[model samples]
Target: MIKTASKRYINNFKGFSREIWILAIVTLINRAGTMVLPFLSKYLKEDLHFSLGEVGWIMVSFGCGSMLGSWLGGKLADKVGFYKIMIFSLFTSGLMFFGLQYITSFWGLCFGMFAIMTVADMFRPAMFVSVGAYATPETRTRAMTLIRLAVNLGFGLGPAVGGLIIMAIGYKGLFWVDGATCITAIVIFWIMVKEKTKSPYIDKKHPDEILTHSVLHDKPFWIFLFTCFATAMIFFQLFTTLPLYHHDQFGLTEFQTGLFMTTNGVMIFFLEMPLVSVFERKNVHKVKIILAGSILMAVAFFVLMLDFWIGSLIISLLLLTVGEMFAFPFSNAFAIGRAPKGHEGRYMALYTMSFSLAHITSSKIGMEIIDRFGYRANWLFMGILGIIAALAALYLYNFLHREPKKT
Candidate 1:
């Protein structure tokens, strides 16, 4: 019995051993460098004295560029190696970070943000592809959970550190610090992270194989994509609408809102893997878990709309974090599971694109709704959409789990 237990422990370690650590480190470094978004609007508004409208435009430009970048990166990863694409992305993004110091006008800020988001987004698909490649079916979910943990931990620490740095030196100091960290990550990737063998779906003789088979050729994949896109629209709203809700309704300060966001990252950092283990052992279907999480998330959003007394915002955030912990990593694993072996980069790229599309759509739509109807009305709309997405996810999960016919 002891020998059997020892062997089981060894197998578990072997599942994640070194490659996962390398990927985790890369995630940490990237997140640490890019965690200044919480303070970015403040810097633009107060330091540079940009109007709120101008800042909004700048953000839209970055999102547009990111959408283009994610698509291009996926295509490039299929042609060039994932490692090469990641290296190029990191270096270029680092350069863009350094260039932020020179932005004087609205156009200059827009251009700088565009360049930075484009290059930064390029690293995303490649990183997802690399993780898919490194992990096996049995361990892939846990591996992704670990990656999420690393990301949340990095994000949690990074903003706190960046906040302090901005308080001390200023926004320029934050930009320089982020730029230096990006360069450091690039160096680390160069020295330590090694690419494994390419997927069988990719052709060694002809790299153009990826372009030949369109992602739309698969029907189920499209269904999954739509589900992701819808869900993300609701998910991304948290960043924009939630804080405003708390501020207007509860009179919470920006610092308090930041604390609420940090709590999300903290929960994921500590609980994601354990949650994964628990859910996986339940023999529950992956899609059911996803559906449940989505419903919970939507409910959490709806709960926030209630005119509760003080501290209710914190409770709502906790509920949303719990739901997010289940949904996000599951989405990653499910997408990877559905991917054709060679087209991992393309699949993951498409998945990430859902996020970009959602952010763009949500910001535009949510803002317009907020303009017409107050924050409460806008959130009600989002909550309704979230419910629709949950129902759709459940239907898709059922469809995907249906039995295949014998030859």
Candidate 2:
């Protein structure tokens, strides 16, 4: 039985195109070097001695930069191509990371964070569009999950290694490593993947593809974006407040905090792909799965309200990781699946923008609430947002099923 299960799991990874595999490899390399972000808030607060409010503002700037980058990357990918955008974004952003460590003042760092993210986040939409181009509709969701698995694997390694680097050489070393990794990943990508103007895969027509109106006319898509934004806000707390809570509540060191985060990454890495494959194979409704994931996230936050035991932290993170495994891959597939043939970049950009916009507010609002009320208030607020998102998703599920089909 165990061997049978293992064989089934391995089979899920089969049938992907060569381009998809190369994209996953490039993603793994880049993400593995992403040690800076998970620890950025702690570095600002503890190392730079920035107040909570100032840290929030700096993060807001970072989000704004990400927002602009997503827009530009999407627009340019449509005009220029995903290949050029991916290479340019990574290489330029890598150079910026090396310079960012030199800035210390609040304004300087704020500007630095924003500028670097503007360049760095351009990779997201381009990468998403590339996945769409490379994978056929039948295998697209699994291909996406494979890429996500790479991301989580990198995240798993990044934090644990970053923690050791901080212990050995301080935060400055993280920037250098991050910069180097970005350049390395792009160079590898350039060598391995030749540029292509159009996708070789032919998309089969489906009823869902009938709603190919301009995105502005799609009320369900807008509602779906809002749901994504809310959940993203809740998720971004991992970088913002959750790390601080690990320290303040449990007196955990950076290494210990990193271990907790590593658990999240590892769980997602191992479980998300197979689980998403199962869901895709079963033809489960996307919004129903997303709503279930949202409810789990809200429960995870509420679990944090039981602050006495450190075990609650573990339990809460477990719930959150499982929720992520369910929500994100389906979300990726849904957004890309809904795009019209020529407007893929635009659709992906809007989808990514929801998370970018969430990043802008999640940190600032979370920090402010922590300052004025406390962590409990922030947790409660996040939980409420999760519930709202889940309700929205539920509505979307009903709306999509009930709406008249386009002939």
Candidate 3:
């Protein structure tokens, strides 16, 4: 039984090509080095002497840059190609990370944060483009799952390592170490990946068919994008709100909070890829899975609302992890399917922008709820929003599958 299980696990990785593996490795390296943002809130509040309100504004600045950067990244990737843009985002972002350590004033930190995130966030759509460039539609979603798996593997490690770094040399060292990894990943990617003029692995489309595909006119894609935005707004509260909530209410240390994040990564790492494969093989509707994920997300917040205990938080994280494993990956598949070949970057960019928009609002909105109404209200609000997002996803599914009128 053990050998058979191991064989199946190995078989699951069979269809992917060398470039996909390289992209996954690059993601793994970069994600492993992503040690700054998880600790940024506590660093701002405790070390820099910023209040929660101030931190919220700082995050808003970061988000503002993220939105602009996402749009620009998508546009540029479509124009110049993913390889050039990705290398730029990685190299410049590493430098920005090194710059972050020097900013002490509130406004200075905000500006610095904005620069780092803007550069860093450009990598998202570019990475998605790279995956689309490499994989077949039948295998594309699984390829995406592999990339996410790499990220989660690194994510699981990053915070645990970050916790140690914070204890050893404080928050500044976290930035330096993270900066080093970003540069390292850039070097590896450049050396390993050769841009194909035309990929033989995936089927090709007629030039004219691609020439006309524009994301701006695609209504169903917009519906999916809005659904993504709503889901992200609720899900990202884990980043913007949960850390402080744990610290303030449960007295969990940075290491302890890191454990929660590690748990999230661990669950996704072990389960998401296989689960996605199984469900896809069964011909399960993507939107229905996403709706289930949404409900699970709601349940996660519901757990948080029900109790202040660490155990409750753990249960919530478990549920939220399941939700993320389901909802997030399929969103990409749906968007990529909507794009024509030439416009993959733009479709992905617009898709990436949805999450960036979420970042823009979630921090300020979450902080306001916590400060004015309290943390309980914040969780309840997130739960309610999750339900609404689920309904939106259901509607989008029906919209996409609706029968066309014969002209």
Top TM-score hit: 2
Model 1 bad stretches (over 4 Å): 1-14, 199-213, 402-407
Better of 1 and 3 by lDDT: 3
The predictions' CA RMSDs to the true structure, in order, are 4.6, 2.9, 3.5
Task: Return whichever of 1 and 2 wins on TM-score.
Answer: 2
- Candidate 2 stretches with Cα past 4 Å from truth are 39-55, 102-108, 163-172, 200-204, 246-257, 308-311, 404-407
Predicted structure 3, TM vs. truth: 0.87
lDDT tens readout by residue for model 1, 122-190: 888887777766776567778888888777778777888998898798788887888888888878878
Candidate 3 lDDT tens digits, 230-328: 788888988779999989988989789877877887778768888888877997877788888898998899899765467899889989999999999
- Provide the clashing-pair count of each candidate structure: 0, 0, 0
* lDDT-based ranking: 2, 3, 1
- Lowest lDDT sum, 10 consecutive residues, model 2, at 201-210
The order of the candidates by TM-score, greatest first, is 2, 1, 3
Q: Identify the superior model by TM-score, candidate 2 or candidate 3.
A: 2
TM-score of 1: 0.88
